[model samples]
Target: MPRPTIEDVAARAGVSRALVSLVLRGSPKVSAGRRAAVLRAAEELGYSPHLMARSLASRTSHVLGVMVSDLHNPFWAEVVDGLDAGARSAGFELVINTGGRSPARERQALTGLLSFRPAGVALLGPVLPASAFTGASAHTPVVLVSRSSRVSTVDTVNDDGRAGSAMAVDHLVSLGHREIAHIDGGNGSQSAPRRTGYVTAMRRHGLTPRVVRGEYTEAAGAAAVRALLSPAPPTAVLAANDLNAVGAISALEEAGLSVPGDVSVVGYDNTWLAALRHVSLTTIDQPRAEMGRLAAEALVHRVRGERVTPARHLLPPRLVVRATTAAPRAMSGL
Candidate 1:
């Protein structure tokens, strides 16, 4: 059977196609009685307007495109929750895609979103270069979450990663952990600031910093721990994120070392996983949902021509101490 169209709706309602269009578009000129009749007819016929077609015809879009760097990470999902809420409240819908944390794939995903001519675009933890963002921002308003940009056309929302990392280091130091190691999130967004913060804090406390090159993956965390064990493992470890910290914990337990007893572990991004009783990890908290909301607001403002200047939202981070960290074994006895 042919799909129901506006013409069919108009025929069923005994109204002109023009009147049906006005009613569907929510025009105040249409009487309430006629509007109700048209809506009832369309519903009875299972007819719905094609959003993309309407957007193209009106030269205005109600869709916002979102590209997330990694779908496997729960942190991105939490951020998307905020983005979706903010977009829907503003009479806009979201079309989401993932880039698998690959720059090439992100570029491709971005191109695909632009093809739809969405009102705006949001990139969550994108690894794409500045040039790519510059090109995209030229055609569409772009907002970045968990990433930084100097492009005047683009907006960014991020937490103070350096301060968060420093907080973690200081917490460990206060627990009498002198030999602390950091598992760094290599090549990931905001990784540099986090690493810099860890090094700065370690030096400030007159303690040597040991950094293990790792990616934002559980495997990387476990591998870094394995490497650390052979060369004398640090009494405390700061992981790139909650997922990485969990992996490090698993590796340490497998090696017959007890968490918080043999070694204390801390992580960044206090994701839901960090709160699990079994995984009760101490971590730095980034307002993931708030960042997403801010990004959405920035993109919407840009789309509506409400703002011409760039928006830079830098939120503060807090540390949540949990069961994973404690005083060093030697200090505990004293």
Candidate 2:
């Protein structure tokens, strides 16, 4: 089939080709009625602007590259939706790729995004070191979501991990759980703050801390539970995230232990997976969509040369209690 062109759109909208061009470029001079007519005509004729051609003519791009840490997680998916909305509203589009939680793969992903020469870039929960981010920011504006940065060139949007973890610990402690265990997000982005918060809250409550080495995955959660079972199992556990929490629950059930009844579990990140009736996980809500929007807005500000200092957005997280957490039962091994 022949592709629709700008001329076709102009003809359909009863406007000149020059008017269509102005509309496509989002010129403020275009009248509201004419712009609407051009847009409606383009939609009906399936006419799309050639991004490369537009970039060559204007010497600028409307593309924002995004690198996601883990595509398999639903949390990142929800965050991307917000970025998409914000970017589109600002006359820009997103090009996204994933790193699968590997430092090597993440470096490759960032390189691929830079190759496109996007207007700006957003990295969601990157596991790469500060050096990698610094290198990337040297080329173009960079925004970090769900991660922190000391680099003056890069902006960051993150939830308060310490406060979130502390909230989980306080909830468990309130439920009469003194022997609560923590399954940490080993080597993952934002893991340190959570661990620190958990430990700090435990000490503040005068309870001994029992932390298990784990990563941000279900397999890690299950393995941590298995390892914790032998040497004085805790009555309640605070998992790294919702996915990890679900995995821990599965392992506990397979070992003939009941959730909340035998061992209460709490998770972080109130993703859709956490809110499922079958899961009903008690977790900390990170406001994923809001975070994404803030990240995109910051990137756009830098792209437009409207901001000089990097933005540091630290959003507060709140605890969402659910069926997964309860008052501790009599401590016992499975």
Candidate 3:
């Protein structure tokens, strides 16, 4: 069977080949009804524009590069969905790569994506230094998600990490939890603000703050739990993220402790995993999809030369209560 072409789409939609071309190119001149017809026809005929051919013919790439820090996390997948939707609507496609949460690997991934000469790049929770973004922006537009930048050429989209952490602490405190410990996301993007917020909230409540060194991984969360147990665990625990919270729960269970009974637990990032029936984790909700969409919009604006200064989007975070958090049990050892 032959592959469907633009001609086939036009014939199926009862439109001229030129009109189909215009619609495929995302020309504003096409009426909404005609554009919808052409798109529907293309979908029915399984006709996709050859991106490489189109780029070569027009000498302009419609590809946007994306570098994600951790592919294992479900949060990034949700964000990528929004990014793909936004980019495709703007007549661009995404070329994505992962850095395994390593700065060196992220630098390499960024360089590899830039080698394609894409229209722009969006870094999702990148671990790379500011210098790397500066260097990349010299060649193409760069937008960051879940990260911050002061460089005039780079744009950033982030949730309020400080406020999110503070909300978690306040919630736990309101539940009559006096002894609370936090497992921190060490060296990760936006980790500092979260740590600061945890400490500040604890001090404001007239409680001693206990912070454990950990990374944004389950293993780190488990290890931190073990360390805290030896020194007498707190009545409540604040995990770095959803994955970390799950790990902390597992470790607690292994030690004959029940979640929200023996020790209440709170997590950051209200990801899909947090909503599972078996793992109904109380968490801080970041607008993951909205952040991705905003990042894409920023890059698109830069690519189109519509803005020059910078786009700094700091979205608010919300608290999502679940089964994992509860008031401390009477006679619970602190």
Candidate 4:
């Protein structure tokens, strides 16, 4: 089937091609009635502008590129939703891509966004180092979500992961947990801060810190749990994120243990995954949508030349207690 074109939409709307173009570009010059007519015509005719062609011709982008580090993680989706809402409200569109949590792929993703020549780019939980991020910022204005930077070129929006981890540890301690183990998010973005927070909080409570090697995956979580169980299993486990915590729960159940009964589990990133009826996992709330909104605002500020200095937003993270965590049970070895 032949795809409908802008000319087709203009004909259907009984307006000139120029008027259609203005309406499609969201020019305020078009009257509300005419704008609605053109929009309806576009909807009826299925006429959408070719992004690359339009961007190339205008040399001005209405598109903001977003590179997500891990699409498998639901946290990024929530953040993108917020970013889309704020961008659309301000007459901008979003083009999204993912890196699948690979540092090399993230560099590729950043390169891909740059190829489109977008007005700005937002990197969500990128695995790339500070240097790679700064390099990308040189090509276009860049706002980073869930990553930090000392470079004045890159803007950053992140939840305080250190405090979030500390809060989880403190809550578990208050619930009578001493033998707590942490499943670290190895090499993942913000992993250092979380690990540091856990270590500091554990020491502050006069408890020995037990760290286990884990990545941001269910398989990694399960494997780490098994390894920890061999060397005297901790009564409570703090996982990297909700997905990891869920995986820990699964591994524990398979090993003949009950959550918050035989062992309590805590997760970071209070995504809807944590709020699931079956999951109900205790986790940290990072205000994902709010961060996205703020990141978009920062990008717009930079794109509009409203701000020269980078907008470094370090929002506070809060702990959300749920059914997955409780006082440790005094149970015998497995």
Give the per-residue lDDT digits (tens) of candidate 2, residues 169-261.
Answer: 999988889989999999888899999999999999999999999988999999999988986678899999988999999999998989989
Q: Which stretches in model 3 have alpha-carbon errors above 4 Å? A: 1-49, 331-334
Worst 10 residues of 2 by lDDT: 325-334
Clashing residue pair totals per candidate (backbone < 3 A): 0, 0, 0, 0
Clashes by residue pair, model 3: none
**What is the C-alpha local distance difference test score of each model?**
0.92, 0.92, 0.92, 0.90
Q: Cα miss at 174, model 1 (Å)?
A: 0.4
Candidate order by decreasing TM-score = 1, 4, 2, 3
Clashing pairs in 2: none
> Candidate 1: where is the Cα deviation over 4 Å?
none
Error of 4 at 25 (Å): 3.7
Report RMSD for candidate 2. Answer: 3.2
Candidate 4, residue 199: how far the Cα is off, in Å: 0.4
Candidate 4 lDDT tens digits, 1-334: 7999988998999999999889878799999999999999999987889987788877888789999999999999999999998899887899999998989998899888889899999999988878887887887899989889888989999999899999999999888899999999999989999999999999999999999878888888899899888857788999999889988999999999889888899999999999998899999999999999999999888888899997989999999999988776653323
TM-score per candidate = 0.97, 0.89, 0.86, 0.91
